[model samples]
Target: MYHAIAQDIIKSIMADEYTTKLPTEKVLMQRFDASRNTIRKAIDVVFRHGLLRRVQGSGNFIIKQPANSGTILNLSIGFDRAAMVEGGPLVSQVVTFDKVQADDRLAGQGNIAVGTELYRVIRLRYLKGTLYDLEESYFPRTVVPFLSTDSVQHSIFAFLREAYDIYGSTTENYVHQVRLNDERAALIGVPVGDKTMCLDAINYLANGDVFNFSQTFFVYPDLELYYHTENIDLQK
Candidate 1:
């Protein structure tokens, strides 16, 4: 129930329904028919996203508002190609991880032949437990045969090194807007018709072998993708 309330308030904030401080806890309790504990928990969830600041003597105040809380994604210079900065702590909630057969489209993405085996993983990324994106990855089983739930819970790159000595990889990134399905919409705190940023990436191994192909869906309103370009003359 608290989760529902939190999401409702978040939706309102996203819609620009409220810019000032939230109503009193008692008022919210009456509005939502929830207990004080539930209301506080809900507010805490919002607070974790840097949306609200709780004052000791007074009450919670807006901290980030809407425009400032969007996430930023980047390609780190030489390592950790998957790093992105969203609001709050970045977390991955594993949805499903299974060994599946790679079809034609999947093979093209992984640079492998059709019918090859691949591990398909779906995860919902959270910023301080608020839904950020829906990430789906296709990893060749031959390349990462030892992939496990524990390894995937955190950073897959780190786990690859610890288990298989696999290191850095070159990545190809593509960005576009995509409409989400109902399931994905619910996961990312948006409606079905709403469009979101989609990042399609393929990572290669040190020896130029294909490692992982991933797609991420981001829903936060304020987001920026950074790219460093050289040799282009601004004077031109």
Candidate 2:
């Protein structure tokens, strides 16, 4: 019932010219002929999905649709599963490809020794032609060999899975608020010191082998991040 009402509201918003502010609870109740509980549930659905944001003083306002950005992380599922779902135009451009000795941070994340050879792959991502994120990834040399510049033009995960049957089953992710420094800002085409969100992820294969360590910076002004999580019953 609430889902039906929510769909109708979404349809109405899409069909309208002006930005659609959600009506008051009373008005929505009247229109949908729903109880207060039903209307509230319907609103919660859209809010959780990033369609709406509520201001303390102002009523609920529609969050402008993300230009073409789609949620990139699904905590409850693997990356391969999520990629198969319908979504936006996701694209990647290789920025840097080189071999370097791992430092303390890189070694720690990859569970490798310091000074071990590591393949560094940097990429810029676009969503529907809009620059969305800048990512830097490090892989232990023992895991991937002869990684060429052209290999990063497509999905790294795809390449790894197809070539070596390697895929991440577990990931440790950390998110932090950061200010982009000059070099990073320039790479992402944003002004220096721009507010950004940084994500550091270390991914492990089913065998508990650390395969990839990555840091991604998202320029906040032009890009948005959406994260979703679901609790799964592990007892089964």
Candidate 3:
């Protein structure tokens, strides 16, 4: 019954009902002929679908829709799964995988000291053999001093977990469009005026320590982004 009510609300949303805010909980409970808990649960179902946002001191608001209405790209997933979901020929070519001294730029990005030893890994990602993303990651040597080319050729997240037992690191991502420079444009096979998106992420350990900083440049038109946020509280 709650699911039916939620679906009815979703249909109403499609019909342009409640564009900004949803009805009050008391009203919804009365309309649905359901208990407060049932209405709240139904609303939560819609909220998890990325449509509703509950603001403090305000009512539930309909969030703006993402670009990929047909497909929601989950950020919680890895590149290999997302890049080749359609079962096409996916490729990850390593451009540069070596240890380098962290310059001022790296130090600022990774929150490490200048002249710190870090492993810089750069790889070009493709979907169905068409290039679309350029991934570059920086890991402080103090964290993972040794990495193999084979390990990197597959999945860095897997390698980190299997080798270093690194798990449950918090990831922070920032998304924005950028105008590609001449060199990058040439490599990406796009003109200088073409636009690109940079997804910058920083991984941190459970103790709130920095682990790695990664930046992936994606072709805006060819790819999209999705993220799900959850609140973790131990108290009941």
Candidate 4:
């Protein structure tokens, strides 16, 4: 319920529903028919997104409009690839790990050659004892020659860095909102057709070779994401 309220409040803010400050807690509680705590929780979620600033005497004030691109300085809000090993009680359950050949489509996505050998891995992540997201990843066998259940149950990146001395140089991310399919929805304990987020990523090694391609589906309200951007003037 708080997630839904937070989503609505974010949408309203992006739509410019409020000019400077949000409604009082009493007003939001009455409008949402929720308790004061629930409303406060929802507001806190928004605040974490770098969208609002709470003034002690004043109400929640708009700090920045989230829809404005290239305006956010920094907002490191959600769990990401780096969070896997950053250590805050994260658990990973490996569902499937198999050696597979990359087909044309898979090759294109990973920027690898067709017929390339790859390790296809599917994992479910639990954050603080709750199902958080599902990740499907592929690693080129040439880059990652061996993988084990034990290694995957922890951090694959950490293993690569320690064992192979392979470090990530860059990553490209494509993110969008998506509705989960029946299988994914069931696996993540969400209703069918529930809205969530899909992040498609291509990761490169320090040697400038593509090493990993992955797609992750994040459960709503369980995940928060923030990106910092800066504007560059080409004519300057």
The candidate scoring highest on lDDT is 4
Model 1: per-residue Cα lDDT over 1-97, one tens digit each: 6756775776565455667678899999999999999999888756644456667778877644234445656532222433346344467889998
Instruction: State the displacement of the C-alpha of residue 172, model 3, in Å, after optimal TM-score superposition.
Output: 1.3
Worst 10 residues of 4 by lDDT: 70-79
Best candidate according to TM-score: 1
Model 2 clash count equals 0
lDDT of each: 0.71, 0.68, 0.70, 0.73
Candidate closer to the true structure by lDDT (higher is better), 1 or 3: 1
In candidate 2, the residue pairs with backbone N, CA or C atoms under 3 Å apart (3 or more residues apart, or in different chains) clash, namely none
Instruction: Sort the predicted structures by lDDT, highest score first.
Output: 4, 1, 3, 2
Give per-residue CA lDDT, model 3, range 1-236, as digits (tens): 56556656755664567888899999999898999999987887666545578897788898655645423344543322232223233467888899999889888887778998888888887665667578889888887768898987877765776688764335676788888888678767888978777877787777776778887778624454565565769797
The TM-score obtained by model 1 is 0.63
In candidate 1, stretches whose alpha carbon ends up further than 4 angstroms from where it belongs are: 1-70, 76-82, 86-89, 232-236
lDDT of 4 by residue, 203-231 (tens): 88657788899888876242445663434
* Model 3 residue-pair collision total: 0
Q: Over the stretch 82-189, how does candidate 2's per-residue lDDT look in tens digits?
A: 141124335778878888998887787667789988889888877667676788988887777657666677777767766776756577778888898888888987
Residue pairs in clash, model 1: 70-222
Task: In model 3, state the lDDT of residue 78.
Answer: 31
